[model samples]
Target: MPIMFGRTIKRPPWRQCKVGSRDDLQVGQALNNKVMELQEQDFNFTIDTAFTKEIRVERLPKGFKMPTIEQYGGTIDPEAHLESFKFVMLFRGASRRHHVPSIPLYLEGLAKSTEWFECLKPRSVSSFVQLGRAFIANFMSSRVDRKIMANLLAIRQRSNETLRAFLTRLNSEALKVWDLDPIVKFQALRSGIRDVELKKSMIMDEPADMHNLFSRCEKHINLVEVLAAKQEKEREPEKKN
Candidate 1:
């Protein structure tokens, strides 16, 4: 049976892709139409569209975890073999859709690509281990260690923004570069690694510290702004001596 299964996404992402003005006229109209279609029962689009072959997903880090139907909280395909699906999705671009939230997008792909799902077989544990080894070897072979280091340290150019803004901007860039160079995609994976690390620390650390790290960045920024304003005021003398 085609293991591919997922739902439609007509909302949740509206905020992320909100229409602003004439600046984004075409894309905005498209998004608006998608929302309206889903809202109006006329929408026949399925959110997921990935052709799945039984592939194995490596042990997913906690945050990269997808939803399963069994989870009362969200969907998780214990049978999902996420790594395989993820690799294919990355290798062969998925059928594009908008408004689908993070994990659900994945499920939508499965739901949409029943034929693709039919061809896949669950990978063996040994084969997966070999693939991991091969992956490291292949990755390392492409360039010497120094180049890898250079790529690792090279940060993308983007202005400072809140976490939400950062994600939106990051997603836009990711879509842009997804095909031109896999490096762009690789960079995104690295960011996911960063996110997973933060989550790990937050879950393990004391609540106060977690809050401090998340909230402190902005708070410190505000404090700097306040202090700078105060300094500027001092430089300007009042009319009365």
Candidate 2:
């Protein structure tokens, strides 16, 4: 199925009705009751949205910009997509931020991010949807995590190439996915902005895991037993007695 975009809000067809406070929504059946009350109070305006309007959401274009909250006359604002990337980097620390993509051999696009971070974990339909949207959006925007994903994806294909080369291919493939210029991927890769590893393709394009392997840190990280190894090194020279 084609991916859908945008918030789907079904306008209620009913006259103006009083909606209880947010606390009202906490009740198990308050929502249904409130809807009933609204319908009873204003039958004319209250209409089922599924029947009234057919809202279809399509995928967003590359570099598609959303209007800032000022356009909506709202005080609150959503965080820029770039901020999310920074948070991931900051959360991981500066040194660990700029490393080559090191995705696990298994896991797919989202499961990796979800598995690693409690904050990023998707426990509900809403959360799952939110995470998915962020992932796709990030993928489209050429975040360094893109290289991490590409590495996982390349490994799945079993191509005899290092992640660096795989990312070059993934960047190429991302262009195709978003219907952008093929050369854009090449240019970005070569420019060192979107570039990952420096190796050339040893094997042609193939499937790979491509999960949980995103990073924008220019620094490197050891995916293999890094935690315990770091701890071991931290000890005082094994306390030579």
Top TM-score prediction, candidate number: 1
Give a tens-digit lDDT track for model 2, residues 1-241.
2234855655343312336744444553766777666544423222121111111122233554332212111121212333444344345442221211111212244434432333232221122234334444434534333233333233222245544454555556563333344344343333332223421221132213222222321122233236558787878587763
Clashes of 1: 16
Question: How well does model 2 score by local distance difference test?
Answer: 0.34
Score residue 116 of candidate 2 by CA lDDT. Answer: 32
Superposition error at 187 for model 2 (Å): 3.2
The parts of candidate 2 lying over 4 Å away from their true place are 1-182, 193-197, 200-241
**Count of clashing residue pairs in every prediction:** 16, 24
Candidate 1 Cα deviation (angstroms), residue 169? 9.6
Kindly report which residue stretches of model 1 are placed more than 4 angstroms away from their true locations once superposed.
1-111, 120-152, 156-223, 236-241
Residue range 21-77, candidate 1, lDDT tens digits: 454576678878977665445222332212112222223334443433221111332
- lDDT (0-100) at residue 132 of candidate 1? 34
